[model samples]
Target: MSENDPLLNDPLLDEPQARRRWWKPSFDRRRILRWSLRGVVALLVIAALYYPVGMLLVHKIDDDPDFQAPATPEGASRAVALAAALIDREVGDYGWPSNDPFFMPGWALDNMPNYQQGIIAALARFSTEMRDQIGRVRGTSQVDPDLEKAAGQLSYSPTVWIFDFSTSWAPTASSEQQYLAAAKTLRSFNNRLSQGQAVFERRADNLQGTLDRIAADLGSASAVLDKQVEEHSGDWVDFQADDIFYATKGRLYAYGLLLRDLGTDFAPVIAERDLKAAWAQMVETFRVASTLDPLVVVNGRPDAFMRPSHLAAQGFFLLRARTQLREISNILQK
Candidate 1:
């Protein structure tokens, strides 16, 4: 059409020019794109800063002068509760029978008749501490010696008599003779212990289940203690915070030994199966467990103890480790 045509001469004649103008980038478009890019960059910067800031804040809060661990009786109660749960899941809730090799009379280690009896004492103390704390919470002061005794009787240990008795003596004839006699006496005991450990090792699912149960128990106890701290703040005024920290430290120390024994039992299997990643994950889990030591609560004051945070952290670390351990178990199962 001619440019001078009536339709072209009309106001709508500029429509093509307007369309071309619209197609061209304007200052507004440039400004918008620039701001959009800046916004995207700003978001990335914030995302990058998020983790470091969070970690620093956590460190500062944990290191604050007011930071305190849970009260002693509370920690003791948790330890007892977790131990009881672990025992209940592995052995019978009432513990192994008197005739079991891992039981008191048969729990000897190189003539040490009462070798793992400390486990019994600690198990019994769970009830003692729990009752004592619960009593104090309710304005009472009494303990059931009978209950403590009964708890001890119900204590169990999977690793109690699973030692290498063959290595207890040399390969000489005299040693062999002595070992023969000892071995004869312990044949039934050794067989039973071996069978128990074998059953545990035969399936990765079993190990995973054990770790999952332990982690669940620990997490549950930590949550319960968190609730207790909130509910019984008045009861914690003189609850001996340092003593609790030290006691927890002691528990962690003992746990280190348990971890060592576990590593010893499973490391070879992991190596044999060429499960390097699984082994590393297990190592990391143990490392996290080790972090729950004296350094976390040694110098903190009683009133300043962040009971909820500390317990939550403890439970979290355990759960993380348990996850890794369960992964290892899964790998072995595969």
Candidate 2:
């Protein structure tokens, strides 16, 4: 028990710091391994749920065939009202996913973006026609300012996001902003038309010109379908088929609605020309084409029995509609 005792002053007891250093590293290694295992498991869990959950939250086609525009204001152009309503529904109600950023779930989506862009393209064309032909009393007359603005805004690229790296590093107006502004301008034009301050000439010639432009657009879409079918047909997994399909569907859907309302807008011309039946058939064909929502798009040969080419089927309807449009345009010329 004495401090000077040889047994109490052993060398092992005097070097406790060395023992502590040896054990400390072992403890630290075990702690690091445990944390690393937990980190890996957490990452695995996130990776497992990231795509499926994100896709569920973000994916929506919104291809409602029977979608009706808000009731047109009395004395306002029905077609203008429909155009504005379609833009509002897509941008505000349905949410524009075509311009989603890389971090968003929609950025990974292909079909929906194609479909939405298709819809916008059709609307842009319609707006251009409105500015050039429908909104003027004659070719020499001044263009309506609101219609010109709407046409320009609607024609903006659908793929632009809040920041466009290709053109500029700074922030820019997004596709949604541009489309919504177009919608606003369309509403303004409609308001002015209702108040007798704007021109929406519903003459037979204007209707014929509008139909001609629309038929030309349909011809182009049909050609796209034709090219896709001709090249990629009978592939078991044709990746590009769905993109073309949905884009065409979106275009047809928008045109169907627009032309339907335009029929009401120019009913007097239609009745006078006795082209009501042909116009109805054309709209019906577009309706059928727009509603072709296959679970999987197959680019089978046009004559293949087992895997029929959806593109070919869609082309059939597209061409039929285009033909009907031409027939109606001819009748209006009489």
Candidate 3:
């Protein structure tokens, strides 16, 4: 082919030129690095936008309030109301003219297990409700060491579960012995409750009047126990009397602890009432009453059949505690 031929000079026929311009790209180190830098910058921009947008969404979706806020006087009052209702219900359940007729003499003995069930249900319910209420109160109430301490003590597992009862009223000698032992335990438990009364008085300047009312109720219960022993001199049914005593002690201890704890939680609320003189009187009442023991003396006499006197003391305390609890409820309501 001649050097001047048209095909030889045509661009399509230029092999080397086509190789440089079309077959290979300008992929030098500087060009590659520049493009890489642009990619990195794009990634950085995307990350920056993504993080803040994600955080903003998270913040918007999470609306929980801080629970560490100090408690208000209103919160303290609400705590008192919750506790007072528990006290009233517990006392009323054990007192004479009980709403649950299964607790009366003939039925109570026959359906002892059922009686136990009713009491246990109430106790469990009280614990659950109190825990929820106190947790909410603590979120808002001012720091209170005595109140916290009382709540700690009261938060213990249900004490009733510590004693096991036979399914039926028909008792073997072993069952009778078991019940008497439980009765003694109940008395000792009451002593423990009496000792804890001091916790209520720890911040007495704040809780004087409410503490006083609780102490008076305790004293009345103790007095009834003493009076019962005094009036009944001769033989007594060991198991029956002890069981009755156990039941009474249960009522007193539950009532007393709740009353005292509520008093602790409601100290600020009570102080707001400005009943200084009344509170002073209440402190005195609690002090004097604390010195007096429940004076439970059931085992001294010989064993006999169950009698009205066996339950008289328990009934008295129940009634007195109920009345006092109602009064406390009224005070809180006002």
Candidate 4:
């Protein structure tokens, strides 16, 4: 019992201190493990809901074949107004999904992105035609500054987000921003057109040339469909089929609307050339083609009995529309 006695300093006397140290560490570890597991489970629940809910909210494919643009102001080109309206509806209203970052819900959407990009592509093509042919007096005439700007902006890559690491590390314009700019420029061009300060040639030759260009584009799209059907037919699950189908649908839908309005714009030419029936036929063909929506896109063999090839069906309509366009162009030439 003396202060420095060896017998009094026995290891057993320190048992309470040792047990306290061991028990404190054990309790702390259990508490930390329980909290870590709870954190992991909470993250899992959030991640599980993130994409599904996000996709449900963000996914929209507005393939309304009968959709019409709001009426243009008096003297404005209806086709031009329609183009601007389409751009606004896609980029501003629905939100351009093709350029969304991985963190966004739109990034998970494949069909909507492809479809919207396809609409933009068609609009870009039409703007080019406007700048080069329709919006000018002749081939040698200077391009309209607004139309030219719109064309260039609309042609910007649809997949570029805020940052394009391919070109530079700096933050760049997103696709939606470029498209919105294009829409603004298009409206500017239309405003100038309404004021008679811009040229929108309604001559027969100009109409013929524009229709010819659209026909060529449809031909190219048909070729793509042909290739896709030839190569990937009969797959149980054709992942690429839906992309191609929706993109083509978008293009056809846009072209159908534009051509419908352009008919009104070129009414004098269409009437003078005795092309009312032909023009109507071509526009109707585009309308019908644009409305072909399948619940599921299947790339079945063209000759398959059980599964039908939607691509082939779409190609048939595309070719028919192109042929009708060519017939109308021939009549316009005459």
lDDT of each: 0.39, 0.88, 0.39, 0.88
Clashing pairs in 1: 66-304, 68-304, 68-305, 68-306
> Model 4: which ten-residue window has the lowest total lDDT?
18-27
Superposed model 2: Cα runs more than 4 Å off:
1-32
Task: Point out where model 1 deviates above 4 Å.
Answer: 1-201, 228-256, 267-269, 272-274, 280-313, 329-334
Candidate with maximal TM-score: 2
Candidates arranged by TM-score, highest first: 2, 4, 1, 3
Better candidate by TM-score, 1 or 3: 1
As for TM-score, the candidate ahead, 2 or 3, is 2
**What does candidate 3's lDDT look like per residue over 37-152, in tens digits?**
99999999986666456434322110111112123232233233333333333332332122123322322231223223233333333333333333223335443343333334
lDDT of 2: 0.88
**lDDT-superior candidate, 1 or 2:** 2
Model 4, span 1-334: residue lDDT tens: 3456544456675755654554564358788999999999999999999998999899988877667778787788989888989999988999987988889888899988988877888899899999899889988888899999999999999999999999999999998899999989989888888888999888988888988999898888988898999889998998999999889988898998999999999989888888888888888988888888788888999899999999999889989998998888888888
User: What residue pairs clash in candidate 4, if any at all?
Assistant: none
Q: What is the alpha-carbon lDDT for the whole of candidate 1?
A: 0.39
Error of 3 at 86 (Å): 18
Model 3: residues with Cα > 4 Å off, grouped in runs: 1-126, 137-238, 274-310
